[model samples]
Target: MKRKRIPNKKWAAPVLGLALVLPAALPAQAATPAQAAVKSIEFVGMNAPAGAQQMAQVYTGASVKVTYGDGTVKTFPLAYKQLFKSTDSVGGTIAGVSVDANGKPIMDTSAPNNPVPYVSDAPDANSLFQVPGMSPTSLGGNPLSLVTHYEYITSNNAGDSAYGLVPASMSLTKIDQNKTTGELTPVELQKVDFSGVDGLWIPCNGSLTPWNTHLGSEEYEADARAYEADPTQTYLSSFVQNYYQDTTKKGNPYDYNYIVEVSVDQDNKASAVKHYSLGRFSHELAKVAPDGKTVYFGDDGGNTMLFMYVADKAQDLSAGTLYAAKWIQTSAANGGSANLEWISLGHATDDEIRAEIDKGLTFSDIFETSDKPADGFATIKTYPSGKTEYLKLKPGMEKAAAFLESRRYAAMLGATSEFNKMEGVTLNAKDKKAYIAMSYVEKSMEKDSKGADPVDDIHVDKISSGVTYELSLGGGQKDRSGEAIASDYVPQTMKGLLWGEDLSAPDAKGDTAADDKVANPDNLSYSEQLRTLFIGEDSGMHANNYVWAYNIDTGKLSRILSTPSGAEATGLQAVEDLNGFSYVMSNLQHPGDEMIVPDPLKTEVLNNIDANFNNRKSGVVGYVSGIPSMEQIAAAAPEESGGGQISSPADDSLIPLRDTAQAAGAKVDWHGKNKEVVVTKGTHTLRLNVGEKTALLDGKSVSLPVVTQFSKGKVMFPSGVWDQFAKL
Candidate 1:
């Protein structure tokens, strides 16, 4: 094999008093100088320009100050790009729309254009799953895909809160990425069919599973107890019945509020299943920890309790043990701090719970209620919303009650149900910390609300604008019953990380909170490589919601994105790297939704939305661009490395299977029967058949510039075949 040397571009050194070590491998050059590595990136914060906040569009004026090992500082401004909107029809159908029995599009006659996009007013939660072995350039290819869930639709332009009135939906969109410019485009969208699970209900915030599936939610679960007493008492059940559009069929309140997992194949087909074992409540989202089995949930409604579900097996949420946190408040300052202790609720499998639901068990079957504290009834408790209830568990309904009436059961078990509007839960694996977004820190979490509550664990000052809390993770913890907890990733303590301040009066832009700080932090995604935590706002306090990037290392807060006036900054997911590029996925919902926009700016905001979006009826799913890849960030850290050759260029260039695949953090396997070599990483898979001029990438056949060969106990593939996995 004759080696060819490509010209190497030298990076100037000693630019900013920083030195980075370069890893070896330089195209077989005779004497290639070490390229300067990236040392760090400092994000320079920028204020939202005056007129931009008054418009109905996503905006970002933030820039990243990158420092090279050689001390050179380069600035890359954060850019926002919308791949698609809820109102935009993709694949001949608008996302988040209801269908009649005949499959006709259900129209919102009151709104312009007539096509109904459910929760177009509240598009939330985005999960980007990269299919293994699939590439953007592959045959009929869809390597990268996005699954976005809509929370709920508004009845009118004033944004009146009406939830569980219709079956919400999540969309699976195939994404196309430009190899050269790193631009992401939505190629096609297919609404995930939830008919198997009786249709999705208020699908809210979601997270991507470690196994590359979208874990969505059915929030604002119907009150089954109330529904049993009166058929019209439950909102979600009747709507779900309407979703079925069948006269004889009745919606079961128990079926509409559980964790929904949607798995997408390489061909872009999606299938969803409801995990009943995770317990049902007003679920914001369930985030699985790095351990895979340990899951944490964000219960969105008032009087919500923090929850954790440890699955019986890794990558499976069908069966788990549910536990509620008892917040042992340590300090009341800055939105409070607490040492958490887990109180075991019970354990059950999805099948068991499903069987129970199939049996038509009502709330009366699981619990007994009383207006006062009787001998059998539990003590009276006040909800964070100021409602009072007295309940007692039935003798044989522990599992049934825990899995079905999770909120009431947790409260009955002495768990702290003080969290208000807990929105999103995300993790920083490197730091072993979990960050939870409290959209508004008030209600039962405040000191004044303890008058009627038996358990007053949280007693922090009211900060209605909200705060983000960091939970420290540790091992060797036991449940309150003294039983050793199985998972080591349990959260030990929690403290406020970042917060928003409520202003005494409205700001110049008509915002009740300071424009510079975060208001109503709702969605969160953390990037360990970037050392930054991304916070998305769902704020009525601020005229325009913004997505801010908080650097954990530098302690600098940078406003990276500003959504349209009266819109919510939701669907936040930070992808450290995908096909060698990084992205911070963000979406804006319900522009011009501000019913409280000050009189001076209300008209201007609405006018801008009419000119841009579909008169505040549309929401966008997109990402923050111009971020460096994980490979580049990893190269920034100082390290010593021995040089190694990667390619052997003969008359026909050949690439070493192990060296090349391992370099990409991929695993290589050989099949003797098929005489094939397979490389897999995450959701991607690459397969090479010996002597064939074609290779299979995530099941799609791709042409090889040269055939693969097995020679002398070693299998080597052509550079062209190898390049398919690396190149766009």
Candidate 2:
């Protein structure tokens, strides 16, 4: 590993000036690099040029990421090629006057003396606002596309696993878009399938190695076909990718439950290390410490175990000790939950349980022979044909003969969670600690179940499972003088904290009523991001799709990635976009959530149409709380329980324009009579002289001043917007 100072055209001025130090190299054993989390990225006014027929301008507020690593990152030179990227100015344009859902202008894309090319046509012409795929659970966010989910690997639930795998290729061809204005610019970048990076077992999530390779987790070697066909049925290829797919097709075929060590070459050829040397069992994620030799990983599904591999040599994944977390659960109590704490059969102090697991294999047999060891636990074995088939632990202790030589690991690491164990893991080399992302799976019925009632005027239910939390690990070595729990690993940093945001208001002020169900990613979409431990979860215990972010330092959630809005994004291994936007990639279904649905053409039509015609120029749209509907009065009854009625004391902050409007002596009818409404044709102001029973445009009689209006998102008007009601 060498450090090359590639002068970056974009970061040269700001970054290079700082003269940051680069951690040149680490021992072959060191696994991952500390990615300094984003400290701040100041919004760089958008100015990229698009090469299109129409003069398009680009705009955006650019921000910088302050890596958690040593402050040595003074300057980062961005070269399209150094990072394997290509781009050009074509297709689409930045909105010269981008508006919020309320139709108020935000960014002005077209400015004089500016020089970014705008295109006439949007590349993908059919995609508009397409919703996502089938959700695994009822409490999750809207089912977005595979692209939106950004799932790097497709599990049996979302994809077909024919030949024990659902084979997919990660390659390239289009940008089709850039977040800019007017027929904007286009950048062409080729997809790279690093050499030895093909066979995908469990396409879960993981970070890139210094070697520029992907360390993917493979759950196990179960029947994925069965899982796909029916969750009720005992399918053999449970999590296999290519289980049911035709594997005869070479180069890119076959996948299973085994952590795949794959990489893409500069030439786009995918290579697979198809050896079953890495331990298996619902492998969820893999994170290599700075010491590549000492890689740490965790098992997610049925069993909640944390294991680390001490690679014998650099780059070699085989021949290592697999140790599980064994906590001194003397602190355990019966909280009357589904949480379980079982000791390892290999080292279970409980003779009964140890003997049970041992019935299948001795400590070493779990690794050596692919065959089951003559052991204890019936649960760990299955007699197939006349031979006993045991769980394949892989390369390290595959045979009982070798079990005598392999190192043993304690199974129970005192992880406290009800239902599902750990779902995400992130290691920080600079701090020498591991951040574990845990989902309660059901903290009172999850986050979005019927009872969560996310709306502002809320009738909330006791939640079953909507907890976001983490576990921290200390340096591996025990503290000097190994007297009691004497390892450097201390329990100082492990605990669950309250995560739901008490969003005072969805907006700066109260207007369109607030809803937690639509705000915080953690609460809204089960998505979060702190430093880097990204957690992908089901919205609730019952709802299955989600993404969460965990900061390794404080062990708290930070931000959240978008949901699997539709087909374009699903099963993604998230990476940051230039603007902190998450980008996911996969080779499963044709329509993923990654790209906009209906295609760019549809999006252009929809965005443009919504921006242009969907505006209400009149000071007000519609007023609520003033004239209560039958349903509103019913809703109000419950509010009394919380505190007061809808007409509770008005907080000035909540009514941003109340003072100015009050001074004008304008009343409710003034909305339609005093000002003009912006229609597709033009603004139309009404006269105040209309009498009662005036003929309505569509036969609904309005007291002349009463009218209907349209705008973006939603707006709740004040009594001052109109004069009087004239229904019926």
Per residue, candidate 1 scores C-alpha lDDT tens digits across 1-728 of: 00010011110000000111122111113232222244456666666657744455687777777655545555667788988788787767787565543444444444556543344556789998676654354323335788998776666334444455656677888887775556787777887888788877777789998888999988767778667877686675547555776656667789878899999876678998999989988788999998899999888766788999999999998988999999999998877899999999999999999999999999888888887768867663422223567788888899988998887888888888878778889998767899998877876688855377766788997787888999999789999999888898999999988777777887677777777788877888987656678888877677777887787655567777878877778899998656446789998876776435666667776787878887667788888898765444433333332111123233357777777887876656554544767675432356677898777654456666678886676777787556645531
All-Cα superposition RMSD per candidate:
10.5, 26.5
lDDT of 2 by residue, 1-728 (tens): 00011011010000000111212111112332211121221111112112221111111112222222233222221111011111121122121111122222222124455422211010100000111122222222221111111122212222222222222222222222222210111222222232233333334444455444556554433432223335334323322212223324222111234455555433333344532334444555566655465555544432234445545456665454444333222221111212122222121112222232345433333433333344532212110011223333444332321112111112211222112333445554434555554333222122234532211111122222323334444544431233222123332333333233222322221111111221111111111121333333322111112233333334333222222211111222433211112232211111111222234433443343223222100000000001111112122222212111122122212121223333442212222221322110000111222222122211122232232222242222223322211100
Off by over 4 Å in 2: 1-165, 168-199, 220-255, 329-421, 442-469, 476-493, 497-537, 541-561, 564-728
All candidates' lDDT scores?
0.72, 0.26
TM-score of 1: 0.82
**Candidate 1 — which residues are off by over 4 angstroms?**
1-36, 52-54, 100-104, 109-119, 133-142, 156-162, 247-249, 380-386, 632-728
Task: Give each model a TM-score.
Answer: 0.82, 0.39
